[model samples]
Target: MEFDHVLSVRCSVRRYTEEPVSEEDIQKIVKAGEEVPVGHFDFKNYAIAAITDKKVLRLLAEENQALSGRGDPIYGAPLLLLIMNTPEAREDSIKLNAGIMAENMHLKAVDLGLGSICIYSFIRTLNREEGYGKYFQALHLPEGLKPAMAVAVGHTPMVQRERRFVARIPTFRIDGKE
Candidate 1:
């Protein structure tokens, strides 16, 4: 798909079908995440976990539900691509790099005709709940790494359609004359 079309149709897909995203597409999405630029050339400080296990997803969703009081925080997506950061990763770098990675993967999912939603509450819950070490450990991340951000991906029953552009964010142009 063209980049403009992908951007036009890209959206937060909260609902997903039972169908699992194929391994091929999953790898493609992960590749997209891996290819994004990281600040300070500290790529080694970040990692992505492609989670598909039903039990693990359920446990994460349960934690999200408990934290946010939502019925299903993940919307039943079959896969979650979680971005993790090590303790040595700077706060600014973590925020920017993780967001870039998630957006890349999310856009790639849209290009592949899959549904995806950038997830943060789950990560927040995982990081906040020190007692929930078991849930964090379930991810099997390398030592010292913690969940920073995530994007849930899977097949969706909804159809994607091009959307007209809208000015959602305020913008201002500055010139020397100003």
Candidate 2:
């Protein structure tokens, strides 16, 4: 698919079907993320945990509901890609790098005809010093890597494409010359 078409059709999918995304597509998505540009020279600045186990997804959804009253925080997607980085890294750098990785995965998902939505509730729920933080132990991310964000992926029954709007155009006149 063309890059513009991919961006035009990409949307946040909140519901998914029972079908699971293929491992090949999953690897491609992860590969896209891995290929994202790094902020600090080393491209290994982030880690990705691809959770496909129903038990783990259910646990995360239940815990997220209990914490934020948002039921099905992961939208029942069959796969959850948790992006992480060490807490010692600069906040801006970590967030920027994670966003780049996630956007890459998101675009890849779109290209593969899979549904995906970037989720934050999981990270928020797991960041606590008490309560749901226990679930973080199960992730066992390398030493200091902290959960930054999550991307839920699976097959969707319907594909929605965003409508293009041309009501406005860019005005690059900074010198007041109209």
Candidate 3:
């Protein structure tokens, strides 16, 4: 699919069908994320955990509800691509890299006719809640690495919403005059 088309159709999908994403599509999505732009310093301090296990998904969804006080934080998507960063990495770099990777994955999912949503609250819940160390360990994250965000992906029947243009665009003027 064309890049513009993918961007246009991409939306935050809160519900998904039971159809599992194909392995080939999963590979392509992961490759897109890995190809995102990292800083020139090449600080290889990030990792992605691609999870498709139903039990773990249920556990995380429950934890999210308890910690965030929101129902179905993952939105029932089948796959959870967790973006992790090492503790030693700078916070700014982590945010920048994670954002780039997440966007790439989201667009890739759309291009492949899958649905995706970037979720950071799940990571916050994981960090804030108790007894999650085992879950983190199960992911086998690199030493000191912790989840920064996630991308929930799956097959969905929901249609993408129309992109409405903003009525007024913000502008900057050198002399404080428009």
Candidate 4:
């Protein structure tokens, strides 16, 4: 399919079927993420935590709810791709790099006839939430790495709402007149 068509086909799928995502597809998703552009310098700093355990998902949901006051429902997807930003890079670079990786994963999932949704609403509260940060620490993941973003991925279980399009207008005024 054309890239434009693929872009249109992709959407944030909030409802996932019970069908377990295949390991092959999972590998593709992860490889796609790894393929996206990280900055030219110090690009080897990003990592991920791919999770499918329902119990841990439940725990994460509760923590997210407690921190943000609204449950960040994962929609029971079989995988959660957690982007980690290692401290080796500058802070801004880390976020931008992670975003590139995420877009790659999203588009790759779309290309593979899969679905995904990015969750970014509760990060400010997450760092200070009781036991949340500690959980990461206890995991003995590399030091100086932090969770930047997460995406849930799975098969579509139902049809979503009608497609909505919003056109983009140039923000700058031409010669400060137009």
Candidate 5:
């Protein structure tokens, strides 16, 4: 699918089916984000964790559920991808890079006939409360990699599309020339 079409329709989907994302689709989704132009696409720029484990999801969801009061299992998502950056990066560069990658991944997933959502909550707290900070290092990421954002992917109850505007903003003549 073309990039424009994907962007036009892609939005945060709240609900998903019981199905799981195929390995091929997961690769494609991550590949699109990896293609995003980041300053350090090198070894330590960002780490993408595509989690298929419910136990891990539940652990993270504990954070969100406490904050939002909704424990829908992250919208029943099968794949939870978290993007991380290290403290060595530019201030907030970790989150900045993850956001760019998140957008790219959202559009790509839409093009692949799937849906994705960007989620952020309780991760930092979890890192502090728990010892999950080591999770990034366990992935072999350079020490100090901080998780910035997460995206949930799966088949949704509805395929979102760009809404057709029913009305347009009225144009006004500002200058006498008009």
Candidate 6:
């Protein structure tokens, strides 16, 4: 798909079908994450995990619901591409890198004709919970890496439509000339 088309159709998909995302597409999405720019050229400080286990997904939804009172925080997506960062990284850098990685993966999903939504509440709740260590162990992340963000991915019944251009955010341009 063309980059403009992908950008036009990209959106947060809250509903997903039961069909699982193929491994090839999953790898492609992860590669997108891996290829993103990072702070201080410190790519080694970040990692990506592609999670598809049903049991683990259920546990994450349950835990998120318990913590935030939101039902199905993952929106029933069949896969989650989790972005993790080392604790030693600066807090601002961690967030910046994770956002970049998530956006890259999300756009890749759109390009692949899959639905995706960037998630944060689940990770926030887990980070606040006292038993969050178990989740890290369950995910088997490399030592020192912690979940920073995630992009839930799956097939969706909804069709993507080209969105009309709009200035949704306030902007001011200084054209390099007084």
Compared with the true structure, all predictions reach lDDT values of: 0.88, 0.81, 0.79, 0.74, 0.74, 0.89
Candidate 5 lDDT, tens digit per residue, 1-178? 7766676687889888879999999999999888888865543657788888766666566655664576753677888888877666666466677788888888788999997888765455546544453333344545566777778899988957786544578877788783
State candidate 1's TM-score: 0.93
TM-score per model over all chains: 0.93, 0.88, 0.86, 0.82, 0.78, 0.95
Order of candidates by lDDT, top first?
A: 6, 1, 2, 3, 5, 4
Q: How many backbone clashes does candidate 5 have?
A: 0
- Cα error, residue 25 of model 5, in Å, equals 0.2
Clashing pairs in 1: none
Error of 2 at 172 (Å): 4.2
Residue-level lDDT tens digits of model 1 in 85-106: 8888988779889999999999
Error of 6 at 92 (Å): 2.2
**Candidate number of the best lDDT:** 6
Tell me which residue pairs clash in candidate 3: none
Comparing 2 and 3 by TM-score, which wins? 2
If both were scored by lDDT, which would come out higher, candidate 2 or candidate 5?
2
lDDT of 4: 0.74
Off by over 4 Å in 5: 40-43, 124-128, 132-143, 165-178
Across residues 28-133, which tens digit of lDDT does each residue of candidate 3 receive? Answer: 9888889988875544788888888888788777766766788887788888888888776677688788888998999999988889999887677678654343
TM-score-based ranking:
6, 1, 2, 3, 4, 5
lDDT of 4 by residue, 31-150 (tens): 988887678665667787777767666676777677667765577787888888766777768768877778888887777787798765544457676534543544467667678777
CA lDDT, candidate 1, residue 103: 99
Residues 20-139, model 6: lDDT tens digits: 999999999999999987988888778888999988898888777877888987799999988988877778788888999999999999999999999888888788766463555688
Tell me which of candidates 1 and 5 scores higher on TM-score.
1
How close to the true structure is residue 73 of candidate 4, measured as C-alpha lDDT?
Answer: 59
Which parts of model 3 have CA positions greater than 4 angstroms off?
Answer: 130-134, 161-164, 167-178
